[model samples]
Target: MDDRKTLVLTGASRGIGHATVKRFSEAGWRIITCSRHPFSDKCPWPAGEEDHIQLDLADPDGLGTAIADIRARLAANGGRLHALVNNAAISPKGEGGTRLNSIETPMHLWRAVFQVNFFAPIMLGRGLVKELKAARGSVVNVSSIAGGRVHPFAGTAYATSKAALAALTREMAADFGPLGIRVNAIAPGEIDTAILSPGTEALIDDIPLRRLGSPKEVAEAIFFLCSDASSYVNGAEIHVNGGQHV
Candidate 1:
């Protein structure tokens, strides 16, 4: 079995997740990624496709199977899980990249968004608690600035779910602290990801840096929270925005 530290990162096929996979792998850590799509040649991180989990986090009923597979993979690979990055999220849009306000967003859509954005981290953290405790691991949740402040480009469900995720991070830190596990969140603002729409262009002018944030910068923040440099950090939300929160 490979002895490198293992990281289970979700939504690794593109954008922030993709950048995270590269960051961890370059640091000599072994990564196990998952997303809705099947593993392909596109992601070239070390053993990236060899250990990718092709499962949709929105399927709340199917978490048992997903967690079981992940646990098995970790068991096979040195029986340790150093970090789990819950980065997968879905922000559904309507015609013309419209934002679904609180009233217009349907109950089903709300449930789906919460399933991936909030519940998956809970499930993964709970399901993999043993492996995490064994390695004295860390968990970095990928939240968004929408959770803290409303964004014209992001829908209501997405913002609320991310808010809940940040809250959940606090709860998780309290619960997992005794077991030597650290839990934290990174709240990004207007990163150049595929999920962006034309409406995002206007928000850049409001940014203090006068530029959009990069996936690599967010990935570096994630890496810090997971690495020993931030070992004392827990239940904190690191903003990756270009001073947009200011």
Candidate 2:
């Protein structure tokens, strides 16, 4: 097996996922990234050198195939996957103008939000547990403060799905810890990402920090959790919200 560590990251097209890929790449770890979109021609990272897969996480049936492909790639490279980062998520469409309990919060919106935010990651993690256990790997679920609090800025579907994700993190940690696998979560406040719609400015003003976090900052926390640096840390939720919840 290659001595270098390997990581399988989802939602790597941009934002926090992109930052994480760059950080791990710089640290000499092999990275395999997946996204719904094809790799961009203008992608700053070197093409063909790193592993990049295209698949929509929302497709439940395809997740198994995607995981198998990732495992095969890792085996071909003579490396074991040391971490799984579940960073892909989508807010409800047309949620920008809707309030938390707005009548417009349709069931389809909730289903779509949960499909990506809660279900996909849990399913993928469960599928990859064996590889992760063998390598004593960790699973980092990207979550939000909205999960813990009732905020107008976060729609019902988005907030509720994230809360479920956080609970899933704890459950996974408990179930996987006996096997030397760690599970944790990061709840970011207002990060500067295109994921946020236009009306987010009003919500940003409520944050005590008065500014948004960078993708790199969030990626840093993920790296620490994935690495031996946080060996004793498991089943913990790290808040990167600049005291937004405190």
Candidate 3:
């Protein structure tokens, strides 16, 4: 029997998610990743195909299907789940990667952003509650520095969705604490990833670090929240933005 811990992570194709997978996998955790794309042979991890779940979080029905699939996979461990990282998110941009403000953004896009960023996290937490309780697991929701303030590149819908996710993290912590589950959030700023919009370098001077954060840096914080080191931490949002929030 595989006695190693198990983690379910979303948006594992690249960037922060990819870094997170490497972080936990190095610590000998079994990773079950979810992404819109199918398992790629390019992935360095072993059993990548068998452990990857191809599902679009933006689709409500697909998310339900993914949850069922995950639960079945967890059955091997008597329904124990050590960690769940809600990291999949979509930031819609206008022509030439222009920011889409609240008024100018279409209703469909707003709903789509919310479905992926906000609704998916809560739904996943609710769906996996039993497994989490059995393992006394932790949940880490990926938020954004834009969630708290207006970012020059992050769109309005994306920012609002992350804000809602942050709030949901707090609510989930309160409700899941009694079950021995911890819930928290991480807000990243100006991370050097594909998700960053063009002209982001201009904001680096304003940050105290005078540089963009690495995806590994954010992954480290997520790892801490999921591990025993953060056992007493709950309902908190850690800033991985190199003093950008200040």
**What is the TM-score of each predicted model, taking all chains together?**
0.97, 0.91, 0.98
Report the alpha-carbon TM-score of model 1 versus the true structure.
Answer: 0.97
Better of 1 and 2 by TM-score: 1
The TM-score that candidate 3 achieves is 0.98
How many angstroms is residue 65 displaced in model 3 relative to the true structure, after the best TM-score fit? 1.0
Top candidate by TM-score = 3
Which run of 10 residues does model 3 get worst, by summed lDDT? 39-48
Ranking by lDDT: 3, 1, 2
Query: What is the full ranking by TM-score, best candidate first?
Result: 3, 1, 2
Off by over 4 Å in 2: 46-50, 77-79, 95-102
- Local error of candidate 3 at residue 55 (angstroms): 0.4
Taking the tens digit of each residue's C-alpha lDDT, what string does model 3 give over 1-246?
Answer: 567899999999999999999899989999999999998887777677999999999999999999999999999978999999999999999999899998899999999999999999999999999999999999999999999999888899999999999999999999999999999999998899876677889999989999999999999999999999999999999999989889
Clashing pairs in 3: none
User: What is the number of backbone collisions in each predicted candidate, taken in the order shown?
Assistant: 0, 0, 0
Q: Candidate 2, which ten residues in sequence have the lowest lDDT sum? A: 41-50
